[model samples]
Target: MTVGGDGGPSSPEAGPDLDAVRYLLVGYSADLLVDLDGFLPERSVAVVETPDVIEARGVRGQIGAVRCLAAVLAAPIQDEANAVRLVGLVPRPPRIGAVVPASDYGVVAAATLAAAWGLPGAGPDAAPVFRDKAELRRTAGGAGIAQPEWRLVTGPAEVAAFRAGGDGTCVLKPTNRQASVGVQILPPDADVFTAWALTAGAEEQMFRPGDAGGSRYLAERLLRGPEVSAEVLVRDGRTVFFNTTAKDVQPGRHPVETGHVVSGPVTEEVAAALATGMRALVEATKFGSGVLHGEWIVVDGVPHLVECAARLPGDYIVELIAMAYDWSLLHGFLAVLEGRAADPAPPVARGAAIRYLSAAPGTVDAVDGVEQARAVPGVCDVLVRVAPGDTVEPVTSSWKRPGHVIATAPDAPSAARAAEQARAALTIATHPGAGR
Candidate 1:
């Protein structure tokens, strides 16, 4: 894993800095990977493992305590088993008690693992209400929140009915998935059978079968409007609303979140609607504490709750918010874990945004304009993950992304424009990789 200092290198202290409590950032090292130049210097910390490796790397002592519980890093079954094994090896759970999973899959897996070990964690039962699209819609509906008309279909019969007599158009999506993978827009008089069949197959690949549940998919009526997400942090059974962000969904689809502009210039009315919808979610999910990532669509004047996750927003959304707001949410999570109160200081900066450098599906042969993109003013920095010889796949989900450029500016629009300019300057060429 990579590490950096915020200001200057810390003076080599006597032994490892074990005075402060330690945190185990589970998941791909990417989440904690960024802005460490700014995040470090505050204290001394250590990382468990790298993203490429599946097994956990043992870290002796760097902080006050030790524990392994990162959701994103534990996605593959092997990683999950390793995380559990690490916890078991510790003799006891870390004194600094809390597990803040930043990914949807992480939250559920972390919760399940923590609970299995009798630690205070969000379990599958509490997690599904937010992680599963079908479950979120159903839970919101039961809580009297307005949801897009939805149907849980298995085979031909259910798909036929939803296609025959539902709204004008319906969106078919996998139940246990995120970032709009295997999502299809259903058309009227559509080849309902064929489309449904394709959607089902996508779900199987999207989720590890026999691991969670079975054959569960959502046929949801497509809602139209400006999209927004309320990224709120819950603490001690109370709601601590963070900055709201504007989302750009895949052009004709609803679930596919292509990119996001933090703190969009939205109307007061829209803000109120977003806040109201989020409040409803906080209640519906019974989310006493932790992150509540909720998305909404403002239709005509009514704001419908699209879906929610009991975790932090991905693609460094929380990082941008932390930078803009001058708060360390990752640290706040730790504080909450230590039963400390949060300081309510709003964001000081005006804008922060991330534009993903997406590419067409193919094996990557070359990438160009990196130097030019880096030279753009207001373009903070570019960290390209895919190399010249790496294969690049279609932008189906957040995982298939080429890389992302995070930019900050005086306002949202300027930041967005700079990001787009940076994106436009780059190009990627793909060819068949060695194996596949």
Candidate 2:
């Protein structure tokens, strides 16, 4: 079975006769639903839906298998309710598996479902540290690990006070958000009060969906150095599977990732620093099962913790890593989920880099040279998530990326150079729009 996101069907074999695997897709939309029926193996493809109206349309003879989508934790509570209600309609269904993130809502749903279904999950108190950045910082710090110096500011007045001192350089980030969605870097000479409003106030406005806003936030001093990420699989008090990669942040942003490259070649010193820091985070959080993707910065040879994510890394990061190292992280994750052990294959190369295709700051009119860029040597695949006429917003959050260019090579410099050449080879044309 294959899971598909916006780019397209992750697996090419959507046919009905693919009796080898059972695919559980998160949500199937345009990329999988359109003009895909003929290609589907008659015995392999199955359609799963949680919406009753969709189910009522008749699923019996339309596909090989049909199952109600039951999610323990959906991004929104409304989605969770819909999924659970739909699952109740299915008879003699297989036992359900819950998906957990570090979000507050995700924590509650995962823990509650584990208790109800007798499944496994992290304890309630430990889950909070993953959700709350402020809590996580304190926990890691108390464990003798280094973290960015940060404070929890309850109000705009406190934000002003925190911003007033120091080199006038700090970062304001939402405690509950990821991918640097509500994070902003401060200017050295900027007005403390005004900048504070834009940084902290914007965070409140962004997360205030359904009248729930104005949550607590964190203001941390930014760390300087090259960023590194570790994808560590922990189970039964042991680091079962581990893959460390280099994180490429946005040019001017603090920790907002534009893309990633795996198989990072680090000296013995840096690698040791990373291992020590990761062990600290795992011990402090008491996370026994599942894989975690964490970020850190090598500051003057010392590694400092950025943040930790208790789920699979976002985007096609897992796919990129696989392409570079010839290791399947998705398969590894499924193995761990089933209480089996996962060991990644030996590293094939020293480095692999993924470069994002971002539109210039304006309204996108057209994109050109995609075919030409793909023809470049060493470039494996080019995925353009947005279309020519799609309005290109200025890069604010990590998801603002238009697409990605993935390449692998013998070393980091070679991979980075190839990615740059490929990025420059393509051009995006933006016309005048309402956007500035």
Tell me how many residue pairs clash in candidate 1: 9
TM-score of each: 0.76, 0.76
TM-score of 2: 0.76
Q: What are the clashing pairs of model 1?
A: 6-37, 26-70, 27-72, 27-73, 71-106, 325-347, 363-430, 363-431, 365-429
Candidate 2 lDDT by residue in tens digits, 1-436: 1212111133333422223222222222222322233332332223333233123333232332221211111122213323333233322114333323323334433433333444444444455676668888999989988877789976656655666665667787787766577687776655546655655554322222432323467878878898888787765446766677777778664345766667666667888888878778878877656667778888888888888876666655676667766776655654554456776566555556788887776676777888887887778878876665577876767767777887767777677667767877888888767332
Which number leads on TM-score? 1
lDDT of 1 by residue, 259-281 (tens): 67878667888778777777777
Model 2 bad stretches (over 4 Å): 1-108, 191-214, 253-255, 348-350
